[model samples]
Target: MATANADAAEVERLYELGDRLSSAKDKSQHAADYEAIIASVKGQNVKAKQLAAQLIPRYFRSFPALGTFAMEAMFDLVEMEELAIRIQAIRGFPLLGKDAEFISKIADILGQLLTSGTAFLLSFLSSNVKCGYASQVLSCISEENVERDAVHKALMSLIRQDVKNSLQPLFKHVESGSEIREKIICFLRDKVFPVKAELLKPQAEMERYITDLIKKSVQDVTGLEFKLFMDFLRSLSIFGDTAPRESFQELIEIIQAQADLDAQFDVSDIDHIERWTSCIYMALPIFTVWPIQLNNN
Candidate 1:
């Protein structure tokens, strides 16, 4: 048996050998070298295991017949005690994505990490949603008991991708009366309103995305949802700026669609409670809270 402690020279020798095998026309002639490399992946040496994890994926396209062994070896590395080695295996996942069926299998394994956990194991988020990897992101965030920091981090990343890319997948799954929808909207509200409300801070690039997110979230909302969220939107100085006015204009249309009364509003007739409440709901966000100064503005 070869010594498990693979030296630097041996690692270089194996790497150079694989470089030849990568371009070789008749790889079957070098079957012994391939087998030896695979064996080194299971060797008790850290460097050899990481080397195999990297090499297998790098030359994945070159050797079609050994894919199963390569994938299993990668998965084994994913579970290894060493973080660097696990990262090497994880980085190889996309290389193996050509097989959609196999990609789903990989997603399932990772979904467990992203969505589920306990103190006894490596405690990261886990996923229960069955969807393509793109949609899986939203599923993880939408899930109950998932940490707030994770959701916020994911939202930031998704918004960075494109605001629409973040919301479409999320709202696609969020139905009427869904806790998921409610939480998403509420989180968006809390994330922006507290900071924006306090300071007339100059618009940062991220604020633009957050503004777009706020605008998109209030769409198709009405009744209690529209009253609460759009009112918060109306109060933002962020929207008062020239740069974001167009975004706010579109959002105003969304507000009017949901909050505008069907019949002409009778302001003096505070006689009817339902009508008066509707009037108040519409007026509160538009008019500053100063009751006496409302007519001046």
Candidate 2:
């Protein structure tokens, strides 16, 4: 009974410290307070660690100037075995990377993490909502210009090394109608497509890679499944004016052929019919505009 009471008191104290950390106004002062928590027995406290993870990003977001210090502190937490702590630590990277001044500092650490933690990060992608955060990190790595070349090289190397093993698991979740699918589509858009023109190898190799991905994703589905495919294709079209025309045309032809067949199918189930109609509706804009855009270009 006495130990239980002591534990309760400890919990309350940690909660109060978390509240103070959250409300901390001065950057140095907040850093000091945060450091104290890390030094305290509460540093290893699970709840305290979770609170620190949540608050560290909030602090960095609110005080961009504190990013370097915050990120340095975060790097320590990234090594923590706890998933919650690791994820929150990972979240802080993209937020810090948004600032150009921080990108160089952030990129090296991110590249290291991506290289060393590829399996862990891939597991996050297989997770439902966590995948969104993971994708955001990849997107930040791809989009930032400061250290882009090195970061992109690291990213692509990791993808090429792990993607074959990774894609099979990802495809299992592809049909779940989760944001994982959308995040992957965006990742491919931002990462893969841009590099096609610059890859040192034969273009067919790159086009074949893209084509295989599309086929794996769209091959088994019809009706509503095509909706995910259409959305993915539309994202691809953002670079339609620049994307490999043959590849884009091939995907469009495949989708158009599927839409045509669905239109003619006997539609006794209204829900199925509605899904098919929606697929066609989604494809219309892509089908109509892509050819015209390609032609005019």
Candidate 3:
């Protein structure tokens, strides 16, 4: 019972400290208070940790000098066992790295998160963060001043390195009504696909890559999966002038097969038929016109 009382007292104390930091007039005193809160985070106090997670971003925004320390703390929080703490850490990202000067640093940190902290970070962002917010963070990293090409290359390399395994979590989120669907599609369309189209050659190796990506996106028959597959096709169409004729033909065949399967369903399944038909209709024009477009180009 005494332990429970102590925990309650600690939570209240943390909240009081948060209030004090918010209203503190002296800049030095505010920094000192923020540092104290950061220290309290190390103790076995859940409330302190939560409050610290919430305040770090604010402190980083208010005091640029504290950003390096705040970011270090945020990265540590990313690995925390508690979901709430991790979520708050992810939330702090936008504020912590909002300045133009911090974009490259943010990109490097994000690359690390992608490489080493893939599962939980991706899961949390996909399920928890709002749709456009993810795109915003990505856009910051891809800004002109930052190493856009390098970051894009690293991201595509990660994707191509394990197209199936790396994207499975993202695909699962799309299937489960997560906002990550829009974020992933936007990132691919805006950052990766455009650059990749220029670099990709009409070679056997490139064909295999395209084939693998399409096959992975089409592996499931869920409605959301179908939508994601269509989005992939749409992204490819943006490179119509550069895309190989044979690759487009293969994609057409895959869509046709899906359409045929949809036709096999009973008339009562009008919704399924309509969905499949729409995808086929949307994709057909791009696939059919690509060869002509390439010739014109």
TM-score of each: 0.40, 0.36, 0.42
* lDDT (tens digit, per residue) of candidate 2 on 116-211: 344444454577445467666674444333233433444454444334333334444444444345444444456754554554135445435544
Q: List model 1 lDDT by residue over 24-104, tens digit each.
A: 888767766676676677866788778887777666655567777777887788678765576566666656655443554
Candidate 1 ranges with C-alpha deviation above 4 Å:
1-6, 25-32, 115-297
TM-score, candidate 3, is 0.42
Error of 3 at 65 (Å): 2.1
Which residue pairs collide in model 2, if any?
none
Q: Write the per-residue lDDT of candidate 3 for residues 82-200, one digit (tens) a residue.
A: 65675566556556555545544544444444333334445656764675577745543343223333334544544444443333444443344444444454455566555554434
Lowest summed lDDT across 10 adjacent residues in model 3 is found at 142-151
Instruction: Show the colliding residue pairs in model 3.
Output: none
Local distance difference test, candidate 1: 0.53
Query: 2 or 3: which has the higher TM-score?
Result: 3
- The TM-score ranking, best first, is 3, 1, 2
